[model samples]
Target chain A: MSPLLEVRGIGKRFGSVVALAEVSTQVSAGTVTCVLGDNGAGKSTLIKILSGAHRHDGGEYLIDGDPVRLSSPRAALDLGIATVYQDLAMVPLMPVWRNFFLGSEPTKGRGPLRRLDVAHAKEVTRRELLDMGIRLRDPEQPVGTLSGGERQSVAIARAVHFGARVLILDEPTSALGVKQAGVVLRYIVRARQRGLGVIFITHNPHHAYPVGDRFLVLKRGRSIGEYGKADITVEELTRLMAGGAELEQLGHELAGYGDVTALDGPVKSEDEQP
Target chain B: MTVGQDAGGPVPAARVRGMLARPEIGALIGALVVFVFFASLSEVFRSPAGIANWLDPASTLGIMAVAVAALMIGGEFDLSAGVMTGSTAIVTGLVATRLGWNIWLAIGVSLLFAVLVGFLNGYLVMRTGLPSFIITLGSFLMLQGLNLGVTKLLTGTVLIRGLADVPGYHSASMVFASTVSVFGGAFRVSVLWWIGLTLLAVYVLRRTSFGNWVFSVGGDVRAARNVGVPVVRTKITLFVTTAVAAWLVGTITILRLTSIQANSGIGQELIYIVAAVIGGCLLTGGYGSAAGATLGALIFGMVSQGIVYVGWDADWFKFFLGAMLLVAVLTNQFVRRYAEEAKR
Candidate 1:
């Protein structure tokens, strides 16, 4: 099948500083394209370009094989490209339903007589959240009260319901704890299962390896490597991300803490074999 | 999703309960208490005549309060709103009574001027991104100066009179200022206008898509814009709406008195803001009600007029007002905090 989105030779610059250079990636429906990077690794710049908040200095972006220019976030949204940032893009004090329908409110009647369909909005919010396996204590409750994971889930559900073809999530699990991260990962999988292309951005290899079909590792504003699931192992990906020399040095430093008896026994052979 | 397996069930009623737990709930209760207190103290307080009397002031103030509340909820302030009324009234008076224009034509010209001032306010704020407080304060001072200087220059006096003699004044004044007899007592036409405007404002705030944008932009401008809201247009329109309300109030005041006083509405902007705040609007924006503002104006009218009915020293009214304002704001702050907390 054709890719849902494709970025060719994308580059971005701020003044004299190059934030991203020669970065290319493809996102396919029912697949997770995990973009892995540490802080200041050009992930934000790349995502901003993709979301149309910033224009790429050099690139051709294609949606379903059709080249398009997105001059604004609204343009991106109109093309069915939805981005859910870490802050979750919601008004904290507003009810879940209100926030869910914030920018694109449903109206009945016509012209000046048109009114917000509050009942329909609330029902749709509840239904959509439920469809995504999210349970709200109250649809009327302010979104700020939900846990970080739940908020991410709500945002994901909103994008999906709004007919987003590609969902770009920026560190949805970074602010969450272990169990919360697991919850969000589940939703990411759920989104993919529903045949939506998901770009799950994260730095943690273990987190990405579970749901990611392909991984693009970024470092210092450049893509260090791209790996398919069959081409890399979790340990090798982790070592590559941590820098092999640094990982080796850390292992040597901690080797003194191992039990001498176990280290000298069959465990040594098992380690050597791997 | 299976019916029994659905994790999303009916949300608890406690969300609204959380809102009720807010300090503003106390103010709401206090408002009720004050209403009952005044109603019980005087037989006239419960009468249609008394209601009309209080509602007349409430209507004028209500119109201003609703607009102020909308602006406040949008996270801005307009200090010139009071003096803007004087300016608009003077425009109507000069155009109709002095320049010999038809009353309707004068009103149209005056409304245009109001819209211009509103546009200036919105444009300056949006272009500069400055706090509206300072921008509108400048506007307030300029309009105040214009009201005094222009009126003195034209009429050789601080007051412009003889508006009653203008063509169409009789009919226009009747529509704008005269009362209709309801329940055997004349209720000021402005009172009906106030109620109607309040209802219209409520519909706009609660039912329209524009209302949603207002809340979102007021709540978080960055998020609202990211979500595709036309923040600039909404805010500019709000400023214009406020100016139009000021024009209406000015028309009623000038028509009723057949004269325009240079300093008539100079200090009243703060009162409109206070009534809005007391009614449940947040100073930081994104949360409030037009109905609440109307109710807040009613509370003010009751306290102001009720003091006289109970035969109390009128001097005490200011003290009472100050206490009410302080208590109401403090309570509303608590309500806002509680509501935010409950959402978390």
Candidate 2:
């Protein structure tokens, strides 16, 4: 089947600085595509393009195999592409229900008598979150009170509720603990099960390895490699994400002090020269 | 909304905690304490007559504070709000007394003037991306000069008078300045207006789509925009609301006294802000209530008058007000911290 979202050789430039270059990936419905990159790996720039905050200077951005140029974030959203940033777009001090329906809040009455339908909003918010398998004790509680994982889940569920066909999560687990990361990953799995296309952006191989059907590793402004789950193992994915040869050399350099076992991966053991 | 464990039933303790989480709880407690303390110390402080006197000042302050509180929650300030009152009054007085226009006509002209100034304030803030404090401060100073210069230029005096003799003055005054008899005490009509506006503000903030935009924009501008909230329009309306509030107070003042001094509302801007803060508005924005602001104004009225009723030096009023503000803010912060920690 044709991919829901396909970017071929997508690139962005900031004046003389090449922020991102020739990055290629595809997101299909009912699958998770993990974009793995370290800091300054053009991850943010790529997101900026895909989320329509900026336009790619070179390459094709296709929605359902049809090329299109997105004008703004609003346009991207209209096309059913939603980006849930790490910090999220939630007002922390606002109630969960309020945050859930902020821009598209439901109202009752007409003309000057129009007002937010509080009962309807609260009921829908509660029911929607419940449908996503996250049952909050009270929808009236400020979103700041929620755990990190819960907040991410809420954001994901919010995008889903807003009719998003493709959800791009920016570093969803970067600020979370192991258990919290696990919680978000479970939600990602649930999203996949719902037949939504998800683009999960993170630097953590361990977090992405189990959930990801396809892996796109970025180093600087270039794509290190893109591999399907059948083409690579977690160890190989981890090595590529960490700059495999550089990490292997660093492992030898720091081998005498502490255990280098953390970086020890399925790096080609026969490359003995460097 | 149930407030217990993930799968459990309701928790009574959570219900109490929820009540405390309201933005106005601290202000409510402070109001009760102030009432009791003053009532015990001075018999006149809690009397019908005394209540009437205090509520008058509170009524005016409440009007301005509620508007300022809304603007604050929308994530901005209007230092020009105080000067705006005087400016609009001067405009009304001049148009009527100098040009011999109808009193109602003068008021309409002043209302328009207020809206223009408000739009300018909102526009400059949005366009330049400058802090609103600086923008409004500039407007405040400019309006201050204009009020003085224009009055001196036309009237040859520092104040405008003879508004009472103007056509339609009597009826206009009746509407804006007349007293309402309540509990055998003649209360200023502004008191009714104050209550009405507060109730209206509360409804708007709690139940309207615009209110949601206010909170959303103030809480997180980037996020609000990301969600497609019309941020500029919302904030600009808030500014205009504040300016119109100033016009209302100004109209009340000039009609009641039949004159307005050059510096009638000078230095009163901070008081409105202080009232908002005491009433449980976060200086950071996105978390406040109009009812809280009204209570804040009421606290101001009671304390300012209660001290005099107790035969205290009026010189100490500012000091007392300052101390009250600090205590109120500290308590609010402490209670909020406690609530958040307890929730966790």
Candidate 3:
């Protein structure tokens, strides 16, 4: 099947600074496309461009093989592109149902008497989260009370429920604990199972390796490489993510002071040269 | 994490506790305590007549407080709200008495004036991205000066009169300022207006998409915009709501008294905010209730009139307002903490 979203050599330049250049990726429905990069690697810029926050300065962006121009976030949303930033786009003091249906609340009645259908919102919010395998004590509870991982899950479920064809999550697990990261990763898998193309952006290869069907690496506003699950292993992904030979050199430099074996990293010593 | 393990969901007892943890719960308790204290101290304090007396002040203030609470929840302030009352009344009285316009027509003109001022405040706040405090404070002072200067200029004095003899004055007064007897105790029609306004506000805040937008914009404007909420429109509407409320209070005061001073509603902005805070509104915004603000105004009415009914010095009213505000905010803090407390 054709990819739900495909960007070919897309570029964005802010005056003299090239924020992103020659970045390309494909997001296929029912699969996870992990965009892995460190800080300043243009991961944010790429996501912004893909999500229509900023107009790409160069190259082609396609949806279902049709070339299109996205000028705003709302335009992107109408095209079935949803981006979940670290903030999760939730009001902390608002109840789960309120946050869930915000900006698009379901309403009943008519004219001046029209209002949000509270019961319907609450029911759907609960059912949707349950479908994502998360059980909240009360959907009426303010979303701020939910753990970071749970909030991410809610955002993902909302995106899926809202009919997103491609979901872009910006570092959904970076601020979470191991177990929490595990929880969000599970939700990401659930989203993929729901037949949505998910762009899971993160710096952690370990978090990306298990769920990501395709991996695209970014470094300094450029696409370093793209690989399928069969083409790259976790160790190779991790090594490339950590700047490969530079990290191998740092590991050897610090090797004498610590038990490097206890590091449990798969970074191979063979990657380093004398 | 420990709490989410229950597949059966939270127990009824815990659920009840959760309800009690709300900020409004604190205001409700404070209101009840004040009612009892005043009732015990003075025989007339709890009487139907006494209730009428207190409800009079509360009715107008409550209307303003509820609107201010909505604005507060939307994360802004209208310091000029009080002065707008005086300014609007001046506009109405000037048009009716001086220009010989009908009272109702004068009121319509005043409403337009209030709306324009409100739009200006909101527009300036949005366009300049300044704190509403600074923007509205500027408006507050400007309106204050305009109230005194324009009233003096138009009428050659600080007060407007003869409204009682103006065209449509009697009917306008009957609707806006007349008294209705409830079981032999006369109450200002504003009390019913206050109730109706509170009900409408609570419905809008709790059951409408606009209410959800209010919370979102107040909670985090950037996040709200990212999610496609119309942040600017929501905030501007809030300011306009407060201004319209000021118009209501202005109409009530002028029609009821048959005259209005240039200084009417002066220095009452802080009182409206005080009532909101006492009713469980956060100064920082995004969390408040209309019912809470109504109760806050109720407490204000009780204390301001309760002191006089019990033969206490009216000078203590300000002191009581400050004290109650402090207590209510502290109580709200504790209650909110309890509400969000995770269980093992």
Candidate 4:
């Protein structure tokens, strides 16, 4: 069968500036497609196009081999494409259950007597989180009290529960510490195991390597390469993401600065001390 | 799925954190402390008669404060809410006493007028994307001017009276100003309206989907919109609700006194906000309770009169209000800090 979602040779331009060009990637069921890019490398522009916030200027965006154009983010959502941005779109002061059911809250009764089904919402939130292996002591706790990793996990679980077939996460773990990021990475794998295709976007090659089934590297608004997991290693991916030969050229240029850094002592001792 | 892993993070002070997380607990405690302190100092202050006396004003202020708290929770403010009460009162008095209209119809006209002003305030705030503070401040100034200029133009004075001479005045007063006898203490009908409205506000805030939208919009507007919450409609509705509340207070006051001053509620807006903040509403929004606002109004009523009952100079009332506000804000800040420290 066709892949769940695919974009081939996608390109975009804002006025005379080329935001993205010749980017190709595909995501199939139960797989993770990691888009690796540095700042201003067309990552956000590509995400906007994929999430239907902006229309692509060229190439084909297909779902199940059916070429289509998404008119808006709502349209993408209706087609089972959900984008969980870094902010997570949550009310931190609200309880977990309330945030979980925020936009599409369940209700009981009718007319003037109608009210939120708080009991049902709490039960579902607890059940869904439990199903995802997140056991909270109380779902009534305000979301602000949740750890950063746990908050990301909540957003992921929310997306999955909302029937998202293709999940596009924008730097989901970037704000987190090392172990916290590991916690979020585990949730990405959890989403993959549930048979949803995930487009995981990040600049960190280490974050992308362990969980990624495929990698698409972008540099300066252009795709450097796209590869299967076996075709690339984390070190190579890192170098490529940082602009391979350009990194070497920059190292050569900064060689004098490196020598001056030796006088700072800690610049030379930074690696071993940490 | 991993089992028995981190499970989020540490929640060592669960019980304390849980209580503080309610936000209204501080207001509730403060109310109780003030009640006991005043009651201990003055026998009259604790008596049923004194309770009725203070509750009368609290009831009216409570009605308005609860509505203001809802708007505050929705992340906006209606500065005109205070003057809207006066404006609505003047409208009711003018129409009933001067237009030869029935008191009921006059009340209806005032309600409609208040709603329109509210809708305008909300619409401008939403359309311009300006801060509600500035927008509502403009409305407040305009309403103040209208209250004085219109009243003067119509009656050649800044006061509207003779509502007692209007048709249906008796019936209107019976509903709004009539007293209920309970344990030898007579409470105004507005007191019941206040209590009933408070309970309703609490139910709407905690048990309804619209209430969720209010909190969501207040907490973070962009985030709420991303999640599909109707931010504009929720905020507009909150503004309209506050206006309706002002209409209620205006109607109650006019019917009872049979007259209205152009500036009766001119500066009362700040007092309503004080009551709301003291009752647990965060000026920043996204956190508060309707019950807390009502209790906040109750504290205001008790203290304003309790000072007089306990033989203190009434000049200290404003000072007492300022002091209470600071104490409440500091207490709320502390509680909020503890509530969010659960997983830190």
* Highest-TM-score candidate: 4
| TM-score for chain A as predicted in candidate 3 | 0.91
Give candidate 2 misplaced runs (Cα > 4 Å): A9-24, A57-59, A219-225, A259-274, B1-17, B41-43, B335-344
Ranking by TM-score: 4, 3, 2, 1
DockQ of each: 0.31, 0.38, 0.37, 0.47
Give the per-residue lDDT digits (tens) of candidate 1, residues B32-134. 8887998999988879888787777888998999999888877789999999889999999999978899999999999999999999998899889999999
User: lDDT tens string, model 2, B1-344?
Assistant: 34222335346755775886688887788888989999999988778888999999999999999999999999899999999999999999999999999999999999999999999999999999999999999999999999999999999989999999999999999999999887878889999999999999999998998999998888789889877799999999999999999999999999999999988899999999999989888787888889999999999998899889999998888898898789878866765553434222
* DockQ score, prediction 3: 0.37
Which tens-of-lDDT digit does each residue in B1-344 have in candidate 3? 11353445456756665675365777788889889988999998887888999999999999999999999999999999999999999999999999999999999999999999999999999999999999999999999999999888888999999899999999999889999888767899999999999999999999999999998888778878877899999999999999999999999999998899999998889999988898888787888889999999999999888889889899998888888889878876765565445322
DockQ of 1: 0.31
Candidate 4 per-residue lDDT over residues A22-72, each given as its tens digit: 899999999999999999999999999989999999899998889989999
Cα deviation of A259, candidate 2, in Å: 10
| Model 4 lDDT, residue A173, Cα | 85
TM-score, cand. 2 vs. native:
0.91
CA error at residue A109 for candidate 4, angstroms: 0.9
Candidate 1 lDDT over A75-182, as tens digits, reads 888899999998757887677888899888998999788999989998999888877877664577677666667778888998988989999999988888897798
TM-score of each: 0.90, 0.91, 0.92, 0.95
List TM-score (chain A only) for every prediction.
Answer: 0.87, 0.90, 0.91, 0.92
lDDT of 4 at A200: 96
Identify the CAPRI category of the predicted complex in candidate 2.
Answer: acceptable
Tens-digit lDDT track for model 3 on A35-84?
Answer: 99999999999999888989888999999999988888888888899988
What is the DockQ of the complex in model 4?
Answer: 0.47
Q: Is the docking of candidate 4 incorrect, acceptable, medium or high quality?
A: acceptable
